[model samples]
Target: MPQRLVAVSFNAPTSELAGRVTGQGATLRDIPGTLFLGGGVPVAVDGTSIAGIGVGGAPSGDLDEKYARAGLATIR
Candidate 1:
């Protein structure tokens, strides 16, 4: 499948989202982006990311990782 990150804007709290997902005990890495916007795993924080949340516009390195999980948790 294609990678995608679910983010609002370039400054979206992506690190925050990734960290959240990881907080639940999941591991995510900041890799290149598939599309020009943003993208990652099915459950990513910034889906339009051109290079994953943390890799693209993540405020902090780890913060972006945390946000992804948190965002997904809200869905469930």
Candidate 2:
């Protein structure tokens, strides 16, 4: 699927898991696509909570970053 249009959601730290998922890409009309990355788990709110991390996929590194952020945006 188109990277910008694709959104992959994984575990997210309660505080920061939402930025890289859907907020920006949902509105950015210029972006070719979005690849939101995630592990399908909820990021623990506690510091001891595991780190929810993943990378956005795209033709370019910049686009990848954007998509990665899109996925994170999906986190609750």
Candidate 3:
């Protein structure tokens, strides 16, 4: 599911699209760590999204997002 988020995020390169893909009854709700709310960030290069990094298992969703951002920074 995370991979799917990455793929959609890479293709559309927008947070709206990512969230839309995981909307209610959108087929990704059942997967664990497949949160569409936050914690998933698209990795772009030269204005093109190439990949994504997602962080899970954090105590809070905000922490998950923060860690994901940290991970993205490491590769940037």
Scored by TM-score, the top model is 3
Model 2: lDDT equals 0.38
lDDT by residue for model 2 (1-76), tens: 2332232223332123334444544543333543333322233454333434334345555454554556657774
Give residue 63's lDDT in candidate 1 (0 to 100). 44
On residues 1-76, what C-alpha lDDT tens digit does candidate 3 reach at each position? 6743653454432233445665466364465665455566777788777777766687865676677778878877
Q: What is the C-alpha local distance difference test score of candidate 1?
A: 0.38
Per-prediction RMSD in angstroms? 11.2, 11.8, 4.6
Q: Candidate 3, TM-score vs. the true structure?
A: 0.59
Instruction: Give each model's whole-structure lDDT.
Output: 0.38, 0.38, 0.60
Tally clashing residue pairs in candidate 2.
Answer: 24
Model 1 Cα displacement at 15 (Å)? 11
Q: Identify the superior model by lDDT, candidate 1 or candidate 3.
A: 3
Candidate 1: TM-score? Answer: 0.30
lDDT of 1 by residue, 1-76 (tens): 1223344333344434444444444244333442322322233334442332223356644443455545546664
